[model samples]
Target: MTFNLLLSLSIALTLVAAAPGPGVIMTVTRTLQFGLTAGLLVVAGIVAMDLVVLMATLAGLNLLTLANQPGLLTLLMVIASLVLIVLGIQSWRRPIILRLDEGHASVSHFMAGIAVSLTNPVLFYLAFLPVFIDLDALTLHDQIVLLALISGVLTLVLGAYALLAAKLKTWLFEQHPERQLWLNRISATVLFILAITLIHSTIS
Candidate 1:
């Protein structure tokens, strides 16, 4: 990837990371139910699993390229765009529900974290990352660099959330319950706009 493209993808990934989604909610819930240590472990697990997903996505994309499946790329772009749009709209309309108390009653925080991160739609969205990067053209070294950058950024963002949840548990869960919803809507709007831009580019 070009330096500029890598930078852009990094920014996009960071923005996605900042969004208040299932993974973030789970991270905060684990902090409240367990402790800061557990929460950080959860965050660690999340990052590790996401990296695995990213690798799988890259391998699958490479195989598609080897098979000369250009249509699959276009189809993925459309599907991903629609998914983002739908998710954004749903988030915008959904009511906020603070359910920290509803977290897993008996499970290892780290294990739960890995499970959530792996199943998280946002992480799976990495499958469509080729919409931004030329996956087929990327050398193994280039892929490693991009993956490392993504993992680093994801760790930073999720770690910040874990720290905040650990430090301000009561304030976040009690005093500012609605903040999560507000952040979710904002993130959703951004995703919607991004999807629209992608669609427009595809059509053009």
Candidate 2:
């Protein structure tokens, strides 16, 4: 709704996307196995899934807002904070078990991307974002802007991973477990920060 909100969203998404996860690993792996093209396909698949998740979240939030229930905003904010906090803690605690034994039986990298996105445990994290943005007040134009922003962020983040994978074929990142742990810590911090920011926004 505001430039500041849009800018914050962009920055937040960039950090989130950069955080090491199944999606990023898949992108890098595909890039190494196939090429940048395969990685791009995976990014596209992830973005498609992102669209689905955002739409579903918006619709569900709209339903709640339309009901004119009292204290709904506060309740949603609490739910959002709790969800983010849980995700942050889980991210910090989750163990990295790289499954590189893929058979590559998929018909196309594009489809594989969709499959990974669909199975992404972090997918529904998108649902908790309504606390940060006023989903019920978004206009059609705002929706388009949001979509474009998200698409751009996804492309930029995943595309950077693809390019990096292409350039550093010898460095697949799996070789360094420490780096993954750092990524997890950074992601967890960001999630916690987001939860705090949401609560602050609602309260003040």
- lDDT (tens digit, per residue) of candidate 2 on 1-204: 889988888998898889886568767766655557777887887788677667666555453342244475456556656756775686578565354232243335565455445434332544545646877788889988887888899889999998897676435435754554565666567657756766665564
lDDT assessment of candidate 1: 0.66
Report every candidate's CA lDDT: 0.66, 0.65
Task: Tell me the deviation in Å of residue 109 in model 2.
Answer: 0.8
lDDT of 1 by residue, 1-204 (tens): 788988998899889888987568757655654457767777877787777667767776453342244465456556656755665675577565566443333335566566455334433544558678776777999989978988898888888888887677566656677776765677467556657765664454
Residue 105, candidate 1: alpha-carbon lDDT: 34
Segments of candidate 1 deviating more than 4 angstroms: 61-107, 122-127, 170-204
Residue 93 Cα positional deviation in candidate 2, in Å, after optimal superposition:
32
TM-score for candidate 2: 0.58
